[model samples]
Target: MKRFLTTGCAAATAIAMTASASVAARTLDPTKAEDALEISKRVQCGVADGVPAVYHWSGKVYSRVEGEPDRHLFNGEGMNIRQCVKITDPKRGTGYRQVSREVMFYLDPETNEVLRTWENPWTGETVKVMHIANDPVNSRPNYPYSEDGKPHQISTLRRQGKWLFMPFEVPLFYHNVLAGDYQDYVGNKYHAMEIFDFAMLADEMLDTKNPTAYPTVSWVRISDWMPWMKMRGRQGQMVFNAMGAKLKSYDELPKVIKDEIALNHPEYNKPPPGDDPRPNETTWTVFKKMVDKEREAAKNNK
Candidate 1:
């Protein structure tokens, strides 16, 4: 069996910086529709320019059945680390860019142990499992000004001096047919729908000098059963509610989680390099591809 796991806000305070000084501050304006883009960006990253930050998240999954109430499924923990670097000098560049990487793993609900291996009840086959998924390096534009961009500007205009938190919803749907040989285990085609609801907030005032002070985010996901569980066309969905906060260092993670990362994927022990250029990919998409590849290999071997 093949398995894979995949998976901001603003505030105000002392007027140390203004819109002209910070690109994030200048881009915000609740009254203007165009500022929505800036708000989205700032909520995900931060208002500051050229500073790195890390985030830690822990949550649980629930299995929802139509007639019966939802039951606990499993626990999950992950980390996302981003490096925002500023490009100075017209010859080299004159803007800010960010490189980010994330990883997530599923664990036993009761034991809180990472689920590394499992035995298939149907085939009695022992399976090596990897419930974790690592995101590809993602690069995006960053905020440069302190008060000019959306982060700072929105704090005063949008939230009206209160804490700023934004809600967003994302829907995903995709289907693909298995290529060859391994079609017997997994049906010919795979289909699923996932809806994500997110709330983003900032713990402190948006400031350019403090790029490490980024937004904290929480989300809930409603989706089809994970493919690796091999529900065999079962009818049900999974619900996940998780909250994440920026961390000062990797050592801040739980000892168990840190040990797992060191043992299985040591490369992720630290955040990705600032220069990494790989683009992010969806977990579902990657999982389907891996399943198909394994099935094809099995077919060819026979």
Candidate 2:
């Protein structure tokens, strides 16, 4: 899929930096109508001056095609698959000094289990990791929505010729900000306003050039994203301030695309768990304990 926004190298870096500084003390308000052109430019790249070309909102990723141009997965400039990104400061007169990466995934391919891992490569940090196995016989074709009326979507393996492509989306909401399906706290029920399975709090990054810069990024994935809001909601109404400010409303997707792919594609999506379990309960418990310990260390700066 080709992203709607087309970016270029220009004075965007400086403007984003200025905006970042300007909004430093202010919390984002979705009700206010911000400048469309200015928000689009700054959100693509964070507050960075004297740099060329920055990524604003979500980054695109190709569905695994060999020898294909890097267009479908990235913006016009052919960048990498970055979910939410922003340029922090200028460096080397080329790239932004600091940036962020937010990745979301459920279940491990080999194990066919729910897997949650959050990491910040800039600081060599791993925020949180969770694993939940999928039930084969009892597995439903659809994911449950949250109690708050928020939608949920699940991506399962789909066979595309010889390879598998896992299609993911928010349950009822197919917007860009929606990270994963909304599930209740108990892991049993669903809620509308529930948060997504992924969130990274206060990650720090350093300048990647000779002259260092100071910048940081905070991220939160609202698990319950509503697609319908686009038609009814105002443009640039929802503002997100993590790496930078991004307009929550996204271009509507075609119904044809949605109908073709139903819940849980069999090809690329991994099948449900089997009776045979090698990594015994004891091993899994130990792994969870270790991961929990790591998360605590990261949080407390220990």
Candidate 3:
């Protein structure tokens, strides 16, 4: 829900590739930041200028606690449609502005249907379920160099035979919008770890002549319970494990996902504009908006 930043499905996953030095030297040198950007764009968006690319993933969500066996809580399915635009700075040289939107649904584990209501095993009470529909999961202008004037470089790129593994681990520890504001001292800041390991053909990604590269993605997320789950601050975390690959068309998605998006989300049919100016959204911020809207409607009725 944060960036290409997030996805999951256990049945959809394949074993991830590991890095190896035995693989021959590649077409584009991974050591170069500009070449790294090309490899990244191929897997994330597309290198061929402005075009929309999509990736879909699904998997199981489980409850993780200190002294107990993890419980299978729910299943999740999600996708992101994104694009990149060329950005140039006299000082920073040329880079890409990446922008996109995404949605993930929580589903019943047994029936594989979207959950409108959930009965917490820990609590006897039933509560409404809230799915993640974060918008504008955009990124800052990414250049080949940083403000400090160093090459915008990266590490941990490994090649195994023909497959190249690009892994991005995003650690989220910002303020939680739903919690109170003394957070800097109170220590209730939002915290989570999202792992996105993309495995693609080394040749395809390094090909400067191509527009994009299709990769198999493995995603794992560990974080707190969603607000709508009504855990009431139960001390536990949720683990989302999933895997999938890039697709050539939206119609390639599962029937359930296609049907749901068609009915509830029209804008999601495509990514946000390349120059979308809105800030990025997370699950907590979206949850706050939902509660605020409900409160306003209830007050008007009163």
Error of 1 at 142 (Å): 6.2
Q: Name the regions of candidate 2 deviating beyond 4 angstroms.
A: 1-94, 107-302
lDDT comparing candidate 2 with the true structure: 0.26
lDDT rank order: 3, 1, 2
Write candidate 1's Cα lDDT for 127-241 as tens digits.
6565656565576653333333423233332343436655556565434432345655654433444332333333343332343344566767787766566666566788887
Best by TM-score: 3
* Candidate 2 per-residue lDDT over residues 25-89, each given as its tens digit: 34322222222222222333323332322221221222222354322211111111111122222
CA RMSD of all predictions: 12.6, 25.1, 11.9
In TM-score terms, candidate 1 sits at 0.65
Best model number under lDDT: 3
Better of 1 and 2 by TM-score: 1
TM-score of each: 0.65, 0.16, 0.88
Candidates 1 and 2, the one with greater lDDT: 1
Summarize candidate 3's per-residue lDDT along 46-83 as a digit string, tens digits. Answer: 54667788889999999998899999999989998888
- Model 3: residues >4 Å from true position, as ranges? 1-26
Which runs of model 1 end up more than 4 angstroms from their true locations?
A: 1-51, 85-96, 118-128, 137-162, 175-203, 207-209, 273-279, 292-302
